[model samples]
Target: MMEIVSSTVEIVIGLLVLIGALFSAFSAFGLLRLPDVYLRAHAATKSTTLGVLCVLSGAFFFFWYFDNYISARLLLGILFVFITAPIAGHLNGRAAYRTDVPLWEQSVQDELEPLLKGKKMKYEEKDMME
Candidate 1:
């Protein structure tokens, strides 16, 4: 019974690892194929983060079960990735926009465009003051 349970656990861990790898590969493909900075960043961050989370989870389970050692570090890594990935992606997209990176031709609506256009540059404001 114990052996059967152990084998099942191992199989589950293997599946998690396999799924994580597939997500990672898909993320890479997205990065290569996506036309613009924003979409590429989105793909890389979202999918890659999920991949890393799954891989870390599998590692956590494997180490805890087989090595008789619970790894706090792996759990912490998963937490860090989950927390930062979206924020980082957002910052990257904002930076790209501020630098005037063009959006893809098929992009339907840019909510930022109008808002950015309405804002005055500091130089323009200074000239207006004078």
Candidate 2:
């Protein structure tokens, strides 16, 4: 019975790892094929984050069941990736926008333009006053 349970867990872990690898591959493809920085950032952060999480989770489970151990480093890595990936992506997109990177022609909307425009006007006013 224990052996059967272990085998089942192993199968699930394999599936998780496989799915994570596929997601990471798709993320790489998106980075290569996407037209603009923003879209690439979205793909890089969202899919890769999920992929890393899934792979880490599978590793976590494998250690827990097979070795009777819980790895703090793995847990911390999962938490870190979950927290930072989206923020990094957002910052990358923002940097590109501030530096005047061109958006794709088919982009439907730019939600940041008006908000940033007001900030830009304020900065320009301050500069002129100085």
Candidate 3:
């Protein structure tokens, strides 16, 4: 009975892990399909996030259940990814914009320009602006 239960759990965990990998793969597809850096950022952000969660959750279940060890590191990694991924994505997208990366021509609005217009906040000296 114990062996049967362990096998079942393993199968389920494997499925979840596979799903997570597929989600991550979808992001790669988005990188090709999406136009411009910003749109691609959305795909990169979302798919990678879900993928990380899926893989981590699978690991957590497998270790904590079948192996009989509570998974602290898996939980911690999930927490870190949850906190950092979106922030990194936003930073990357913003950097792309600051460099004047082109947006899709069909885009209806640009919120970043108005945000940038508020004031000339100087992060560096005049020579840096050039």
Top-lDDT candidate index: 2
Q: Write the per-residue lDDT of candidate 1 for residues 1-130, one digit (tens) a residue.
A: 9999999999999999999999999999999999999999999899999998999999999999999999889989999999999899999999999889999999999999878875747657888999
lDDT of each: 0.93, 0.96, 0.89
Worst 10 residues of 3 by lDDT: 118-127
Give the runs in model 3 whose Cα sits over 4 Å from its true position: 1-11, 120-130
Off by over 4 Å in 2: none
TM value for model 1 = 0.90
On TM-score, the candidate that comes out on top is 2
Candidate 1 residue pairs in clash (backbone atoms < 3 Å) = none
Model 2 clash pairs are none
Question: On TM-score, who's better, 1 or 3?
Answer: 1
TM-score of each: 0.90, 0.95, 0.78
Candidate 2 local lDDT, 2-70, one digit each (tens): 999989999999999999999999999999999999999999999999999999999999999999999
**lDDT agreement of model 1 with the native:** 0.93
- Preferred candidate (TM-score higher): 1 or 2: 2
